[model samples]
Target: MPRARNTGSRSPARGAGPGRAGTPGRGQGTPAGRGQGTPAGRGQGAPADRGQGARGRGPIAGPSNDGQQQQARAPRRRRFRPGTRALMEIRKFQKSTKLLLRKLPFARVVREVCQDVGGVDFRWQAYAIMALQEAAEAFLVGLMEDANLIALHAKRVTIMPKDVQLARRIRGPEKGFASL
Candidate 1:
């Protein structure tokens, strides 16, 4: 039988050397030029050999390992004092409250009531306005209750002059009904 052919070799069947199977044959100096030479494989035997002294360097050294340890042990910084933070919160609340008051139409009535109650001081105005708003809310609730009572007790109803005036204003004079 014929000899089994070694298909892995690149050399012809005549005269091939031991290192000629996959090794770089001639003038290839760098490991990359060689077939099986990985950069990691080159650094495998001696780790310290591929140190900062290599051809291509990495990023500059940061604060040393010791410096990082010291920084980690350093005291934390205080962002704000408790009193200062409270004051800031109060000021923000006041600003938002003032903006809301300005946008509300009924805020004028509340302000007028505050003025009548001698709430001239800027700081005291907020409390005075709050009181006026509460009073107006109570008055509106009372008026609604009276209207409901009148609607429910229709038999013994007595309309006031103000109600008649309101009705006359709502129903303007017709074409020839003014003389009557």
Candidate 2:
């Protein structure tokens, strides 16, 4: 087996040692470790270089990790409790308001509420939530229209609790949302 030239111990001087014809020897006429007369920084015969540029690191590679370590994750926030939850802030946009219920993170809160009610395997699906949101909006709009009419018949513009109650009764106990 041919041995790799013992370049480790050689001092970088121009034109020193038995030179490889192409790679200029350290301190040999190569201009301070410049490979093939290009530049000194191209990892020619630089004593400290290990040719890291040829094959780069893996995905998620960092200076601290050299493929021997797993990346550490940041700790998760504590579980939601009523008192602690009150301090947290959540942003909601005006457009989503028409498509969503007030103060409700429907999907996550649906799962939590279902779990509280002892539901077995309650997984929240996006399409199901979206459909339910639309259905609720439709039901509410129709109900509010009927309630407003009842309030108007009573010579009031503002819909009262009694107006909604009477509207539900008029819509009846069998097919109405009162049964729901």
> What is the C-alpha lDDT profile of model 2 across 1-180, one tens digit per residue?
653444434344423445554355566643432333313345354433223232222222336543344345556777887645544432333234456464357666667777889867576667887787677677776788899999899998788988888878888875356663
- Identify the leading candidate in terms of TM-score: 2
lDDT of 1 by residue, 2-117 (tens): 65543444345323344543233345432322232213235342332232222325323445657768677879877896579877976786576333233256666555666889
Assess every candidate by TM-score: 0.24, 0.39
Poorest 10 consecutive residues by lDDT, candidate 1: 32-41
Off by over 4 Å in 2: 1-104, 116-118
Report the poorest 10 consecutive residues by lDDT, candidate 2.
Answer: 52-61
